[model samples]
Target chain A: MTLLSFFNYWVVIILMMVGFYCVIARGNMVKKIMGLNLFQTSVFILFVSAGKIVGGSTPILRDGVEVYSNPLPHVIVLTAIVVGVAITAVGLALAVRIQEAYGTIEDDHLRDDFDEEDD
Target chain B: MSPNELFDLLILALLIVCALAIARTKDLAAAVILFSVYSFALCLLWVHRGAPDVAMTEAAVGAGVTAVLFFYTLTRTGRREK
Candidate 1:
């Protein structure tokens, strides 16, 4: 309805597109993982922003404070952050292994190397 | 616009720059550094929006742990994109 609200979602979408472009256009495995990280972070921002109330304070309770922001997204995002870290760790480990196996982590090189091995 | 919106606009601008920087860089290390900056902006955005828990998590995981992990991987692999 309003420009501000629309901008919020638009920013997330734009960020996601950037990450997606990195994932698809880039050839380096590490860069792909970074792109994936960027993508996930954008989604987290979108969810948290959606849970925020215009006139609300943090979820902490107080004697006279009302209209606290939603805590569900916060909890969900906390869990997601841990999962994201785990994923990143595993991805980096895989990148390291890919380099050791192929002598290079570039996607094209890896594909070529794997094909050579198959032949 | 209000102060909060103004801050959000600034962070949004920095985020765009960081994303573009990460995308265009051919140096893997430089890209990781840009990603660190991007994550810091994300953390600040969360703090500005009153989500301290998420902010902390973003700082620790996105900026801290993830960066370290990538650098470790970079050590094992070469740093150039090609």
Candidate 2:
């Protein structure tokens, strides 16, 4: 593979790992959502990267440029962005409710609070 | 290998390290910050992949909106050990 292509792939892989790590390691509910957002963002990167052509131009109607980057990926990413925003809104709402009910957002703390209630 | 490839490898290694740190961190705030970094890295990835629009959206939604939401939630809740 060319140097650029290799580089692009590496970036996507790295971001994916970081994002996954955030979701799994954080005790705060909000942090987990942040991690989830990162993970999804990485996926978006992957899709866009996949659509790239080394010599392609923008997918606009033009006279001379014969090669153009895939427009499908652009459309997909736009939709994904909207979806990501909606999910973030929902996640925030849930976090708000969780805070109201338990008075804490930390996973460990929330678990303990629940345990106390159970007892 | 080319210099670009080496740089890519270095960045990938850094990303892995950051991800592991995020997973291992005990502090919720730290985790959130790490997650934001991850999103930024992903945005870079999108740019590298030649999709500036996707990268832009990722930066705006993933790094900006999501981080704000998480921070707001974190602040609203108490941090005292239960």
Candidate 3:
């Protein structure tokens, strides 16, 4: 069997690991958020790709067009994208407040700030 | 391999490169910009896969709204990682 048979899944897995590593390894809060975004986007890609069929037509119905791709994933991803935006907004707001409190968004500095506050 | 398969692989390669760039950048602003490029690539991948609706959502939310929101927050919170 050729690698193409399963390489698409491998791509998504690599993205997942990259994002997960960024979230765990990065000290910057914004980088962490972007990592989360990348992770989520990879999953979205996986889902949308799963819904594709070889030689499938676009979901739109028209004359002489058959074998339409799955529309369910599209609908699901639409809602998911909105939720992701909401989550990002809230996360950023929290980051802003954290910045105001500690004057830095670095995880290391935040720890230092917390320790200093305990004095 | 057909042209379609080759194009898909090309986009996949670009996505991986962009993801690494975003993850490796120390500057938060640069990472955010790279992320916009990443999202645009993702939208293209989806469009290539025959999912225009998902592609549209990815473009609008991922590239447009997310980038703007990050910039707005960055301007207030400052841009450096440390």
lDDT of 2 by residue, A20-93 (tens): 76678667676677667657766775677678776576676769989878879888988988998898889889
C-alpha TM-scores of all predictions = 0.96, 0.74, 0.95
Those runs of model 2 whose alpha carbons end farther than 4 Å from true positions after fitting are A2-18, B1-18, B30-34, B78-82
Off by over 4 Å in 3: none
* Candidate 1 per-residue C-alpha lDDT over B11-80 given as tens digits, one digit per residue, 9 for 90 to 100: 9889989998999999999998999999899989888777988888888888998898899898889798
Where does model 1 exceed 4 Å of error? Answer: none
- Return the clash pairs for model 2, or none: none
Q: Between 1 and 3, whose lDDT is larger?
A: 1
- Model 2 accuracy (lDDT, Cα): 0.71
Assess each model's interface with DockQ, reporting 2 decimals per model.
Answer: 0.82, 0.44, 0.80
Candidate 3 chain A lDDT trough over 10 residues, lowest sum: A1-10
On lDDT, the stronger of 1 and 2 is 1
Worst 10 contiguous positions by lDDT, candidate 3 chain B: B73-82
